[model samples]
Target chain A: MEHEEAKKTTFWANIGNFFKKIGSKISEKAAKKAGSSNKTQMLEWKKDGWKATVCLAPALIILAVFTFYPILNTFLVSFFPDYNYVTDEFGSFGFDSYALVLQDATFWRAMGNTALMVIVSVPLSILIALIITVLLNSIKKLQGFFQIIFFLPYVTNGIAFGLVFATIFSPMDYGLVNTLLNAVGISSVGWTGTTNIPYWAGLFVITVYAIWNGLAFKILVFLSGIQGIDKQYYQAAQVDATPRWRVFTKITVPLLSPMILYITITSMMGAFKSYSSVVSLFGESMGNGQNETFITAVGYIYKYFNRVVHDNISWVLSRASAAAVILFLFILAITGIQMWANKKKVHY
Target chain B: MEKELYFASDEQAKKYERIRKVRLFFVYFFLTICALFTLIPFYWMLATSFKTAEEVQRIPATFIPLQPTFQNYINVFSGENAILLRYIGNTVLVGILTTIFEVIITILASFAFSRLEFKGRDVIFALLLTTMMVPGEMMIMTNFTTIARLGWLDTYQALVIPFVASVFYIFFLRQNFKQIPDELYYAAKVDGNSDFKYLWKVMLPIARPSIITITILAMIGSWNAYLWPRSVCVEADMKLVTDGLMYLFQNEVGGTSDHQIMAATTVVSLPLLIAFACFKKHIMRGVARSGIKG
Candidate 1:
């Protein structure tokens, strides 16, 4: 506990020192600009700082325990291959945990499934959203009604909805999806087959539900975005008799590109972290035992190391942390790349 | 020339009106179909909850139940396996506690960030923003360990404590608090109010909508939380409402209880649906704000 406390203080001090250096420079500039009052400002700040600390204490303590310490400790634990998590002991530090994760085929499959979900779902959802938003933009009647209908799923429980989707595609002849397919002269297909769910079938089911869930938010964004666009743009198109398709392609698409980009990044990140959707569609095993085909990277962590299994949890826990760290870094790089590309974006 | 111009312009206007009506008809057509895509499943979930087992199994699935009954709902609540209320109680307890604690901490932290002149506040806030980039996956494994070590597993604290301090809410609430105008703080001081007193009496009331938004989001988050609770609160009794569905899934006999399962899902889903119906504006804006903020 003392060691943990020491590390926590040092982390805080580093944060303090890093800012204090730059803060001093900025304050010095202000001091020169506002000479006499700057002294009083300093005195006032001295009084305010302690009060701020007192107010911030409860939050700071909770954040340190739950957020900060865990991030640092997880990274540290990943490197300590021989780390006995239960006893909190480690003989030496190594990368064996990472090696184990990289060598495992399940991890690779998890990554593959995750990549496929992101690649397929994000762009499709965005394109479909943009199309709907544009179409909704052209009309005035029931647009609010449509927005509310689509947005319903956004607040509802995802697991419950995933189960709903599971039933819709329940593979039974009486299932809604299968029944519809039969009406269209197609044979019944089991999208979420219990005994023998095909990999592609499972992936297809997950992506469909994901895309459907995604529409609510994307449509909300574009509908709201369309309202903010100056009416003059549409008026200009109207006066020029610009083709509807051309106006949609030119004005609407370009105007909503930033939101599209943000949604793309967030959707991909959300897809990467997906766990329940897969669990909801397939059973808890993600698939039948050896045929377990649908585990995303996050689900992989959840599946193997969800509990502290006494047998090999020490070694396996490190591996789970290693897998999580890789996922963390990949997501970090994704956010960093997007932020660097859009330098003004302050948060994801 | 004037007569010719009028005739041609009139013809063009008629053509435009014809095209406009066609497009509008298609718009309504497509939008209705899309709306039904979402609304149908919800309708099905609700409709199925009232379905009898035989009605559910009939060769042609009933669109609306002909033999609608409360038996499925009763079945969900009555059997020894009916932990639906227990799980819902657990979820509500956890959600209320987490939301209250998180909101208080957020108000305090946001107050400091927005109103006070703390030395490292900017950098600390900046650091918090960067934490947003760090995937939540990183926290789960280690948090699992931390909670395990503390023997908090299967406990409400395991569910509530880890999630109580949120950087996003602090940032969100601070933005609203900053708009409260610094002059109020000065005026409060002149009136002999302490900083905390000023915040409590002045700042919070003004930031009420933002507070409500954060509160709804936090509650919804707790209500929908599956993975975290599934990990930490593994015991059957401590499971969340979402888990109640999972429990129904695992213990389902012959998987033929689609009607009862749907009933369970409907009950599991009702609180949020009702909450949304009540606070639609705050919920929608909160979602929009979460996306748009930084």
Candidate 2:
């Protein structure tokens, strides 16, 4: 079967295999000046080039059609404020879309919300995860057992769990967190209340969810990093009767700095693209009767893209594309800066 | 002097031993609390999933279900709630098909990049690497236009096609493929094996673990996918699990319908949780490898 299928190589592959066979069947005697001609031959027709073409064609084509083309197309569409989605036409291009998007209060609020999610959630998660990782790394008994317990959230659906957080944080008498709050003599704070949900309340719940949801991966990364640190460093610290805080700071943290920075960067990046996490918490409206208080930039773009306005979808798409480009550039700049900082600051 | 530095006397050694025990106790105590933080949500999810509807909304909510029942699960699979069941089925079908095709395509591309002597292979690989840097969310708008042009909206292809060719998986599989010895390829050629045969028979066996990781990750990606599917496949039958979850909230379970929502989420989360438990080592190793690499 394999042989038959190999014989049945695609048209391009057959062309490549044909060239390969011809090239090989030529005796060295016939091409004694092989080294001189080799450059041209190699450039024009590499051995098994057909196979590579065949193997790579699907990915390249799919990526071209879906990813690469869309990038260029998005850039174009972002500029063409009147580009039509349904009709596949555009009026002469301008900066109308950027002008519109830049002026929108919702778009700016979405940006603010995304920034908040990143700034608030990323650092807190990193700190809490760092502490848990230290504890998890120090233990001897049931380490695997505890790890599996902690990793439970990693495999579960983020949407499901975000809703679970929503349900848990529901500011009702029966809500679990509310019940706990009542036990401490505080009343409900309207965290997920259906009407008049406070922006701060929504932000707090989202931050807590982000920290909880983001911890598993960060812990796993840090724990692995901690284990990779040479045991000799700790032994040396012990020999000197180094204080525990000193050991953690001078020896362990120095080595773990790279991983720390790594997790922070990834967490930030993940937070930047966050949509489902926020939507799952605040539902479709993102905040009922509160004017989209929890909506992120992606959610803003998503809202415009699926806004279902009939006559001006072109305007809608252009706005979304503009927002997307802004998002892309922000991510590129942030990642680039973080990477630069990571290199300069971390020893590893 | 070393002994004196470590412990001044017998009493000092005993005191240090006692301190060590106390410290260990505190460390375990701390870890247990953090672990409970992760577990309590799942506990609430499962416990509520089994509770009778009346018990779920009682003031000062019940920590444990007084009468555990499967009626909510039955409802999820029955009546108007059956749409949730259809969404789960759609997610599974889409996930499986996408993984199979993705694995095959990744293998072919990786094998080509790894072993096949091709013109512009280095340049193409570099192009792929750069493509990974572009955030995917930016492409959603134009890609939606393209898919609409292709008339694929409200279809399974809309959900599956955009995801099937991940450059990250291609790069990951290529790294594993490059690790194979050159002698193996030369020997396979001398033994008259074709490229496809060699990939199927030799390189694949060596790269199985990485391939399995890609497969698991792909399935998880599909299972958790929302943003694209939410925009494109908004039809009732075409929704993936995550999208349908919100649909469940909006169309089926209301704001106060906590028990039914718990039931739906539990059904969605169980297969994945069980799979991870059974394959914990493989999963963690895969995650660790990705996290450690640049």
Candidate 3:
């Protein structure tokens, strides 16, 4: 009778264990469902974060296709033989294009002319800008009107202004400048005709143009810098009976250094890449008289490309690519040097 | 002795006063001269514009036109050269549209760069800056071909599309946006506001100065733009004011009618001059701030 009772108890226990297993299985299924929902929410959050990139991609790709890709292709084509734009034939990779560019006298002459211009123009612009800024700061009444007048050169039509200046600097007394000189009992000078003189004159006019164009902005920046200085410092120096020269040298010079550095770098870069004014001055028949002043690196690039499209036709891509690469490296090296110098000088 | 000492002090004071007054006069005189020198080009252009063709070519060129007439201005507005008005319209339209597009692209890109934390974000920004450092001429040839392929030449798209997003402007706006406090973001998050709403309400208002600055810069840049317009707008009807002036110089044209071209130039430059007059302080401040930051 005892053995029969033990068998019945054992069967009931086994049945209870089976029910517990089924309950546990149901809970596990529910947990899996909950985990997947969490994952779905995480993915939605990810999409939210990536949304900006999605919006920016179209613009970036357009920029790259239009800007970056062409630049790379141009660089690549520079290494090849006679690239024809019409045929879209980027011949093959070789350094022949570079060799032609390096050997070309006009290319070197253009580079030299641009270098002479930058060497002459950049520092003069900086110095004159500083002087003008100092003088502009000292003025008080009708300051706004004067500032506008100073900034006028920058706003005037450069091409038209180039024409005006051309007329003024015209070799004969009919020119405005020569007429003025004759009125003042000075002999007429070939302001735009003599090779060396015109080259230097072009440099002078370009520098003056840059300086005058830059003056108003530079003055405004300098004025702001000066205004930012606590008046107390000047007052303190005055009380201590510091010499005016000392005060200017010790206070104003140091304070304006950062702005000076900025203007310097920009002006230097502008001078190196300058072409528009030079091109305007000497249209096509440059290398005659003062026409030699027309050969900026950028102008050279334009000339090479234009020459290719019209005459050579085959080497357009290769020649342009080589010129651009060289120009790019030249600008990059100058800018790098400038930036390094700026960092050393621009004390906070 | 005491009386003599007092008299001497008074005389010395008087002498110092005279010296100061003399110094002030010379300073003012020097400044006025510089100011006049600065303005002579405009004066010459304007004075030449109103003169007859003979007066422009006259030796001892008249400092002031003897018989100033509105003929040049009228010609530019009504004669065969009447496209001056169209040129102005084109400039304004291009300037306004370019500014709008640039502002939008720059603002959106700036937000992404400054606020968003994603993979490769910094790297992308650095790459953009690298492009900024490259000289602009390096890419012009390629950009020209790209536009040709896209068939965007002679269209406003060619003028406005390639430069719609400026890396320099983007970096500038991003720097401006970064200066905002992060607690604002936390507060918005606590309110369960979406990130877009948070940026729209909180960050944008704080970045108003930068937005305005970028807009002005874009406008001025587009307005003054020469080479790109001259390159892309090969057709006469599509020319900008700067390019239109080139027509005044074309050999087929008279090429050097001083009065008409100068008058047109003066007219072309009028809008910017007027704008500068109206907003000098803001522009100056914007320029100064940009120089410092840049």
User: Residue by residue across A74-102, what tens digits does model 3's lDDT show?
Assistant: 77778776666656776667898788888
- lDDT score of residue A228 within candidate 3: 72
Q: How do the residues A1-348 of candidate 1 rate in per-residue lDDT, one tens digit apiece?
A: 111111122122134454666678678857776765667767888999889988899888988888898899889988988777778886588999898899989899999999999899878988888888888876777777777888898877888888888877777776777777888899877688455666777778888898887788878877787777887777777667688789887887777666665666667777777778888888777765456688889888776576454234566777778888998888768755765665464222
TM-score of chain B of 2: 0.92
Assess each model's interface with DockQ, reporting 2 decimals per model.
0.46, 0.46, 0.25
State the C-alpha lDDT per candidate: 0.77, 0.78, 0.68
The alpha-carbon lDDT assigned to residue A307 of candidate 3 equals: 57
- Candidate 3's C-alpha runs over 4 A off are A1-48, A139-145, A190-197, A230-233, A284-292, A308-314, A343-346, B1-16, B250-256
lDDT for A9 in candidate 1 is 20
Most accurate candidate by lDDT: 2
Candidate 2 clashing pairs, residues 3+ apart or interchain? none
Worst 10 residues of 3 chain B by lDDT: B1-10
lDDT against true structure, model 1: 0.77
Off by over 4 Å in 2: A1-45, A308-312, B1-9, B251-254
Model 1 bad stretches (over 4 Å): A1-39, A307-312, A343-348, B1-8, B251-254
